[model samples]
Target: MITDDKDFEAKSIIARMQRIDKWPLPPSFLAIIALGYFFTFYDVTDIGFAMPSIAPQFHLTGSESLFLALSIGLIGYVIGSFIIGYLADRYGRYPMLILTMILMALGSFGDAASVNLDMLIVFRFITGLGLGADLNLIPAYIGEFAPAEKRGHLAQITFFLGILGQAVTPFVALAIVPPFYYGWRVLFLIGGLIAVIAVVLRAELPRSPRWLIGHDQIKKADDVVSKFENYLKSNGETLPELKTDDINKINVQTETTRLSFLYLWQKPYRLRMLVFGLWWGLWYIGNYAFLGDAATILSDSGISLASSILFLAIGAIGYPIGAISSWAISDKFERKYIIFVGSILWLIGMLIFGSKANSIALIVGSFIASYSLAFLIGIAYMYTSESYPTRARTSGFAMGDGLGHIGGAIGALFLPLWVAEIGFFGGFAFIGITTLIAGIILVVGGSIATRQQLETISA
Candidate 1:
């Protein structure tokens, strides 16, 4: 009957998407979504910078509590990703995106107002939930819209802004923390206020037509794609005609739109989850050891808190530089090679960082680490996002990066306990080794998508 016409239209919408050569959406829309990406990465290091100030305020008793103060939100991140990822997959990205941002605003504001360690832990967990979910959605959302060849370049534009947020945090802390009694509170308050702004911005973000098509919302999906087609046509661009095969692949995908997080364990998806999950865990374990504990290591090495912040700030310059570099290289090169090289450099940077506690070595080493890690993540995130399909992409991302916070938490906790005995070189060596393993594993597992349509790659 005519009831099946929706399926035909849904498939056509996807065909239109695959044919467009350039980004079909307005540039400003992507810019707004990029702000969400910025804040998510920003919060990753915000607590680490705030830790020195936070520790004394609550009279924290041990390294365990100290590291926990730094890493506790990760637990919230894991939980939030699961909740929002599922909701986004089942319902849609737009609503879940707003929910995630609201959680961050509440959590950030809550952390600022906290009077004790317990209250801070609670609020931080709330913030992590939003961060975990928002990050889980952002890449998948971007991946759906970006042309296959241009995917990496477009994604980097948002991630580049994000790295700058992380880089800017140290200076934000230096400006705020050293001067005011509750400068740390003000720093957190800033995260909350900006998150509120992001929530407002989310209202303008459109749902992925790809997502709608996958769920058989054909009329709506076609409506979105037609607008983009018209937009491109108005600009005098000629979109290529779609072959019949381009639309056929989606028919298999449409019989049941009941995909869930658990479905990731099925044949095609199981290996992806295992491989990408390990990569995320490994990446976080190493990166967290440095990012979560960089300030602590510096402070322990006889650098004053202000000086620790300053040195970190000096290295933060590399974050933006590396992000820009990745933007340039991501499309032209195979991502696997890029990942392998970034890790080797990341290890070298760690070695340099650990060579001495003095400013000369700290600044140089930190800059290298900062730069390489930025590139590593930018490339790796795109690589991982490319592995999954529209139906499960958000949850798949949540599974990889959200739960990867646990690995990060472990890395953050491990260094404080060991750094005192093995010294700086010893601690970083462990992280470097861990990072190298992740890059190697990446070569053998999951999808290695480059210049391929998402539908074809996922299939």
Candidate 2:
């Protein structure tokens, strides 16, 4: 019995030693982040490709089809964002992420085999709930895990994959629609498959140590941090040294219980909530308006599915390219400035495209706008995440991003009707105005936020 006890003690000591040794980022964590973001993007783009096929199946008018595809998702997203955002703050980012993935996987599987428009709509709404959670929690989760300097680059990967997923949808539609009995159903099937894989991969990811610490699970949090550090050291990267002084800077005393929307409106947080909410709403309206309608608009220009798919790929490349470029310079300038420039460019491109309809110039203009919008959104993630105190980071992102989906729903539901009535030019012009106005508001709000110094809250 003594020998056995000695053996157990030795093992425990070795385990403790292993925890102290710093290590590089685990491949599992990176894979989980990638898979999670990839599906998020895939969900957003899938509806666009499915639109043509879905339109005929439901006997939906052009606008009705568009609304059916987008509005339901946005509604679910709005609810999910706020609910999960609050949950992440109260429970932990990791649990919330995993829960959402499960929700998304189930939603996708159900959607793939849905028999009617109503059932499909219900499943899509469920999928939107997952997407909403991702939009709210994933970036905040990534930000918490990443090194300060590397945060922008790592966070930008989510956007990069998002665009790639969007690009893949058009190609997928083109390839499968010809042979598949229902091309749109294939998109849902693909979504289900991706979600399954993502959920499996995500299950392997370690919970964020920061979240544990925030929740006052000190022993567990330290264990997680130690493991991450040891993993980094094994990979030849030194773990970041955490000084108690630095920890004190962001620490806030709380119940370590789950937070709610009510807390978001208290004191200084109220200002942030309002500002970010407006920003999100506007951003959504502007960005989705372009993305959801891109295929249809190009189709009107006599572009074949093949040409449209190729051009869409080319156009979508702008997102990653712009995001990467922004990352290179993100540390040099304030994030808000980058967003402003991108939005301004979006306005110019949209105006040029709308005014010069049915021409090569229009396509070029649209592509430029799409690229600029990606960069704008990339910057927005950085800005929004950075804008809040660490304790309420996920909540800030969720509430803001959730509110943005409201605008997105409006853009998605209405833009198609306007396009049918006024042509692509008019539709583009309308989005341009919305974006331009949003840009102005952000610029003004950012100034106010900077002056207020509420960005880095101390718990």
TM-scores of the models, in the given order?
0.96, 0.86
> Local distance difference test, per candidate?
0.83, 0.68
318-363 in candidate 1: lDDT tens per residue?
Answer: 9999899889988888887788788888888888888775787888
TM-score winner among the candidates?
Answer: 1
Q: Candidate 1 clashing pairs?
A: none
Best by lDDT: 1
TM-score of 2: 0.86
For 1-459, candidate 2 gives per-residue lDDT tens digits of 114443333233223322232212554566567677778877887776666566666776657666876678888898888888777877778788888888898888777777777887898899988888887777777665665545566667666765567556656777775346687787778888888887777777777655554455556755766676566566676534544344333323333334556666787667777877887787678678767766665665677655555566555656666667776666466667777888888888788777754556655775677678667776687577656665677777887888789899988877767777888778878887777777777778763222122223322
- Single out the weakest 10-residue window by summed lDDT for candidate 1: 250-259
